[model samples]
Target: MNVRWHNGPMRLLAPLRSGATYRGWVWLILGGALMMPFMLVGAIVYNWFHPEAGFEGALHPAVFAAVIPLTAAVSLLLPDREVERTAARRLLGAEFASPADDGTWNSRWRTGCWFTLHAVVGGALSGVTLGLVPFCAYLLIQGARAVLDMAPTGAYVGWLPDWGLLTGPGLLLALVYLVAAAAAGMRALAPGLLGQGAADRLAASRAETARLAARNRIARELHDSVGHALSVVVVQSEAASRLIEADPVFAARAMAAVGETARGALAELDAVIGALREDRDDARGPQKDLADLASLAAESGVEVDLRVTGDLASVGRLTSREAYRIVQEALTNVLRHADEPRASVLVDAGEEVAVAVASPAARRPRPRPGGRGLIGIAERAAVLGGTAEADWTAPTAAAPGTWTVRVALPKGTA
Candidate 1:
């Protein structure tokens, strides 16, 4: 029971035993020693201006305030500022995820304030720590006197109180209090002066948001391009296998189509991977726009009728690229799930660039949880101030029931 009780309490003091705590104590003492000369200089200058007043004269509080700014300015403007900042983080164990630099006006002012406070408090604590040495020596002498049965005379020990409540236990308690208070004061001040500023945090968050968006776009592109290629290869390979015994020429053409589709897929996949490699070097490659839709439709291994009604030169790059992906994903869905492997693509690039893909509906579409293809199409359109919709249309006298995916995208860079 005793061992278990002591274990919990011992963990609380673990920080005090670390090397960082020892380094902090060293920096505290050194900062105090360095600031003492500035204090002496301020005192000398004050005395020079007031010839009549000696050291006995009481100094005004404003005089001390004036000296503080002077020393603080010197500390902040000099290259020692970096040393102090690094020491505060590496030695004093400042707890901030991302600390801002001391370059801006506000950061400089805060840094000056930190230096001023540290110098004053550390200097006072240094004196108290040094003073304990003499206090211990005096107690030792008094103990020796008691052992020898010789009373302490006025010559060796100057005017002092008897060793009792006033000098013995009371002095030890005061020492403990002083040390604990100084440690607590430093621990409280480090975070406020050393942590990141508001602007730095905002900039970091924006960068993270941009990174996530880039990764999401890459995933959508992979899905549309690679998924379409796989569906074509599967359909063509099965058709070739069934016809190889009946028609040799038709089977050869099917095999050739599969090879062509595989090569196109490899090229698109390589482009995506190359873009990822470029990201590391801080460069971005071009995206597949609506102009590439012709080649995509040709390689889909199905009957496709594509038509464009308006001028596509005025469409924005993002809207054009997203529109192409929407068409590609729509055709991929039809090939994978529909019975008739025939589709039509109509692109009307006017004030708003609109794209539509329709095919004969054989089965009702079932919604699946966490489907990225259709959801990606919707998200891409939404990002460009556009909208995407998928539905089943009633059969007309000229055509059977149809499944359609339609998207409308704004033109400008809004």
Candidate 2:
């Protein structure tokens, strides 16, 4: 009997040791509390219409049952799924892909179902707790009196027969398990009701893809425009510093070139930033194209032997713009990594537009494989259904091997 008694209480009170049990109780209590206002309004409305029923009659079980459907309908129509999802996540430990309102019929009905289930189950459990808890307290007191060998007062005993002392503990244990099961059911249903549907998932995926593409485009713009400008500024400033004392006129020209390059870079930087900010009305000048290659070469701070074989006006705007960026990035690499800053640029516009930039290979260590400039060139070419290649040429008797970047883009009729 002693062994059985000890193990019995341990098993009965085990759920009290778990924090989840307390959280579950709180969740149910909240659901019950939320239902009260709806119940009150329903009772008031029913009493207002039927004066003979009076307040007491209006507060009937039927009125409370009617509020369950009212709650479900309200939950379905409201655009507050985010609020409900957050509550479930924090209280019930539900996992949802996103808490944003999906605005779909599928999600709406699920939320409505969950809301109705919560109200009904919570109301039932709460009603049971109010009666069962106090009765259990009375039973505990009576059991204590019996253990002490004290005679039960008539008021305390009333019309109740003496059951076993374990009755109170057993009832409390059953209540705990009941509450736990209800909580588990609610939690299991939360994700399906509150989580993203297939359409929501697809939209999220597309948004992510667009975000990444925008970021890459911005990176390429900064790399091709600002990167090339910085490279030119570095070379021109250095030349000015070396020639300032010996050849003042040439030094002045170099300094002037630096200023022009800086201003142009600042403009391009503004344009890219404006684009990022989505400032549609900001009239940043149009992007450079193959027609602007001559001006680009002139400001590159390097001697570029530029050759054009066909009319650039015939090239579509997209192809021309991308071709310009590819050449600009190639020239920028030449200035940054080549042994000699001088390079040869070739642009041939035909059924396909071809661009090539060649410079002496660097005597120093080459840049790490897949540099951003090279990658940008390749990405641009691929976007137009074209191809790009960067490789080292065989050394000749007159010159060491040259690093060459070549790109070809389709000449779309734009």
Best by TM-score: 1
The lDDT per prediction is 0.73, 0.83
Residue lDDT tens for model 1, 99-171: 4556776667666777777776666556666766567557656755655767874444633323422454456
Compare the candidates by lDDT and give the number of the best one. 2
Which residue pairs in model 1 clash with each other? none
The TM-scores, one per candidate, come to 0.80, 0.78
| lDDT string, candidate 2, 91-192, tens digits | 777777862456768778877777777777877787688778888777877777777878775455742314426777778888999988788788888877
Candidate 1 residue-wise lDDT at 69: 70
Instruction: Give RMSD to native, each candidate.
Output: 4.4, 5.9
Model 1 segments more than 4 A misplaced: 1-22, 46-66, 97-102, 140-150, 153-181, 279-287, 360-363, 393-402
